[model samples]
Target: MIRYINIKNIFIIYLVALIIMVVLKGDLSDVLARMESIIEQRNEGNWNISLKPFESISSVLDSYNRFGVNIVTVKVAILNIIGFLPMGFLLPLLKKNNTSFIKTMLKCLVFILIIEIIQFIACIGVADVDDVILNLSGCIIGYIFYLIVRPVIKS
Candidate 1:
């Protein structure tokens, strides 16, 4: 079977997806306001540091232990994990033989780190460390999906 996708198309689609993610994460007005606050905070040397490495995950588990996985906790888990799945699918499609998994993962790590840092600085979101972990987990999940679908798509 012949697939219609090429590296250029995948790259363009991936870039668009990433831009969508950014816009969804913070709309322009909110982001600009947050950026102003961030500048003020930086000038005052007063930072908003709220990095919960495992707190949210543990909260979800604890809630599950008590209530057997409610919708709120489920959404938390699912959203974080499913968010960056496209990254996993797009990279391998972008370059087959030349792409290294470790390199790709590291690139994602750095990108996530940068996003988190900006979010934290701008006070746009919680900037949880757990999001990085969860998004990376999502990427791995996406890669697994890619592996499963690649052959089928190729055939």
Candidate 2:
């Protein structure tokens, strides 16, 4: 029982850390400074919000075609998916009862949505629908992972 409590605590810590890393991807002071600067300048250009899904993916592919191979562009897409895997895995584990797929998905969607909103409001990154898609993919993958591992852990 104590071991279970420790594991749960660890998961909670990891989730908090993940949120900080995703939402505040820099020094707190630096992020605040940029937020202040953007608010003061009212830089419409800096407010890069994308509602259309795959717009970012299309842009990345276009960059790849033009540049012949850009690791950074590819990395962003992959990271967006992989980064949220922990959320999918951890959230269900944190719940006292088994969560249905739809419920788990809703939880993941809401979590990602909040992060995207925060990023947009802070002017830190592009608030992209593609990111939500990719992040949700990661979460689904993570949920699948949890399903696989649950039996093993129980045994």
List per-prediction Cα lDDT, in the order shown: 0.73, 0.82
Off by over 4 Å in 2: 36-42
Best by TM-score: 2
Over the full model, what C-alpha lDDT does candidate 2 score relative to the true structure?
0.82
Model 1 lDDT on a 0 to 1 scale: 0.73
lDDT of 2 by residue, 41-142 (tens): 555554557899888899999999998778988988888888888878877777648567789999889988988898887676668899999999999999
lDDT of 1 at 100: 67
The Cα RMSD of model 1 versus the native structure comes to 3.9
Estimate, for each residue in 27-128, the C-alpha lDDT of model 1 and write its tens digit.
778677876776687679866554768888888889899989699778867877777788876676666664566877887788778877767755665577
- Cα RMSDs of all predictions? 3.9, 2.3
Model 1: CA > 4 A from native: 1-7, 10-15, 18-49, 152-155
In candidate 1, the residue pairs with backbone N, CA or C atoms under 3 Å apart (3 or more residues apart, or in different chains) clash, namely none
- Quantify how close model 2 is to the true structure by its C-alpha RMSD in Å: 2.3
